[model samples]
Target: MTQQGVSWIDKLIWSWAPESFKEAGESIVKNFWLHWFPAKVSRRSLAFNYSFWLGTISAVLFAILGVTGVLLMFLYVPSVERAYPTMKDLDYVVAYGWLLRGVHRMAAHLMVAFVFFHMVRVFYTAAYKKSPTGGSRPLNWIVGVLLLVVTLALSYSGYLLPWDQLAYWAMVIGSNVAKSVPILGKKIQFLLIGGTEIGQATLIRFYVLHCVFLPLIALTLIVYHMWRIRKDGGLACMDQMVLKSEKERVESVGSKTYSLLGITRGMEVNVLTSARAEEENLIPSAPNLAKRILWVTLFTMFVTMVLAILVRMPLEAPANSAVAPNPAKAPWYFLWLQELIADTTIRLGRFTINGGFVGGVLIPGVLALWLALWPFLDKSSPQAAGVWFPRERLRQNVVFTLIVLGILVLLFIGGICRGPNWDFYWPWQPWPELPMHF
Candidate 1:
């Protein structure tokens, strides 16, 4: 009954459970949760703060998505003919199916949101910088960036699985954008959709991608990211560690004696031990990480469930290749690119550029490359590490803030302000009547 409080099933599974099984369970928890945690962390590193808990919340959201997604797989049929009806059945027929569907949908959304915020938090605190006072590494920054990409890819791939009119056109616009790339555009689009156009093959491809490949990559990267966080001194304590190092260095020398090397004639050699001091600025990982994971998991799941109840998962008309919605749009996350296309065009001499390539491939590609190289590119002092929006880092922060604001502005325009034919219109305006695709 301890395994399942509902009773009969629990009794069947656990009442006759061996004592050895119980001992093994307890031992596993002790080894993995208790022993592993304390070995990785120190007392001072566990600060009770919002920023410190973003990663945990993101991880919890991922776990929720994984569980709900697996449950959904049991009910969903990926073929175009059955997909929409199956989705409807999930909502109308299956018991608590809507709850599972809603949770999975909302969890993916929240996970992406949290992961973006997590990156913002890391950037502001300069956590990607290596410590000059010693205990830091920047390699995880690249891992974090790759994880962000995988998270977004997972969302985008999953978006197509519903195979509604909305999902179909969104993928069409997205795939068209992929076709805008220079020489490899069509090849990439074909690879993605499994054909030149979206069809049955595309549906299965997306299902496999969303269900398998992207999740596996994301999980692997996330595990490495967490391990690196611990290896790099357990979350941005560089500020305090730097000060401690200075204090210890001063104490080791006894007094501020002038170096004889500077005076010239002869140099005084002070013998110091070769062993390095093991400084403990970390909080106990067992309590800190475990408690954080527990609370954040509960809170995130609760909010997601509430959202699932209040807002029904959107299901539009069944996909018809003969019809296209007025002003077909990409998913919200990629709406900024759509807006960019609406606003800009590139020209070099007599040749004009594909707006899709410009906005979707070129701009995003440049941004991604810059981000991947930022830790190596940044020339900021190590003292700037672990400091959020410090005066010394004002320039860097302002640049990043402007970039974020620009993307948000574009998202707003594409998502809320575009009308039929992509004309400018206010969000409050009633949507124009749907027109049949020619």
Candidate 2:
């Protein structure tokens, strides 16, 4: 191509693009959206192995859900009478409607999974711990916990939109679980379902929650969650690096002096009260971090689209309150709780314990509370932060891992092994047929 021919194209591109490194750094600070990110980030924080990019993938999945969900909102009807028919239309009538719905559903599930994995990664890395260099991260950890709850709530609220037998019974089981709470159980159930049972009111309430309330909450929490990362001085790994460097510097220089001069001047003064060299591990976030994020977003969306194409979303027969499926089950994510309820429910003579309350409410509540308050209780040294499975944190990691494995075991049993009337059956063994009813 001639220089004259390409000159106009180059001009067009450079109109927005920065021509120099200085300009690129300035653009990151000046742009509103990019400003949320730090001007520079540690190279350690950029490694895929360190954080697994799960948080980035989760955020991208949420964005996919939001976009596809809005498209679905146009075709879906909230009324119980029309909900199933509209779902059928989306599956067969509208152009690419099935794909849209599939993508949305798949993204929703992936977001939940990724968010959960992200939390686990944070726990194992001890990224939630506060350090002298990392600042306080416990508050951000609480925000993440709340975000997880909102994510699950978002999924649960949307589950009823199809109004199929699976959705209806799942909602029934969920509401009943709510009703198992001690004092406010009944009230909570009533408020959730909008009366004694699942009806038009229930559908509308869930629709509003799924479409409006929960998404808003999730979006807000996500924004704050990312912002908190910036405020906390990048990832916890950066703190580890800082601490290591400080230790090396201290050992190299025997006796040192500390002064307040660097504090007032906004310069980092070492133990010798002298200005140190700029951070060696830092790199500009404009192209480096932004490019990595772009790649992750594309990769996540591609995986979700592939899954959407290959898998068909389930659409059972229209909801029938009177004719429930034998051993009607909750959503797959809640299968663990369902299994727990079964295991905990016991009879001693005439008195029986309410397993729903014990397994669904009490146990889960205590677990969530413990997770939220754990940063305070953790007595591990700062050195443990950002180190995967550090020796000092091994016991807590083992306990957490065991709890996670237990939940997975229960989920498998509830979802795969339970047959009609909630009887135990091997996956290879055929379930006995029930008598036909007129």
Query: What's the TM-score of each model vs. the native?
Result: 0.84, 0.90
Q: lDDT tens digits, residues 1-438, model 1?
A: 354333444322222222553443333244434433434343434555426667788888899988999999999999989999989998889999888999999888888889999889889988889865454457899998898899999999999888898899989998888888889999999998999779999999999999998999999998888777767766665455655556556664675354445563322222121113323343333334556556777888899999999989898998877887888988888899899876666778998767888888888889988988899888887777776776888998999999999999999999999988888888788877865676
What are the lDDT scores of the predictions, listed in order?
A: 0.77, 0.86
Residue ranges of candidate 1 with Cα displaced over 4 Å: 1-30, 40-44, 48-52, 132-136, 251-283, 346-351, 431-434
lDDT of 2 by residue, 1-438 (tens): 345443433332222445776866765755544666787888889999999999999999999999999999999999988999999999999999899999999998888889999999999999998866645799999999999999999998898899999999999899989998889999999999999988999999999999999999999999998888878878998878777767756754554343346353322245333223335677777777878897999999999999999999999999888877878898888899999998888999999998999999888889999999999998999999988899989899999999999989999999999998899999998999986322
Q: What is the lDDT of residue 435 in candidate 1?
A: 54
**Top model by lDDT, which number?**
2
Candidate 1 TM-score versus the reference = 0.84
Model 2 pairs in collision: none
Provide the lDDT at 21 for model 1: 39
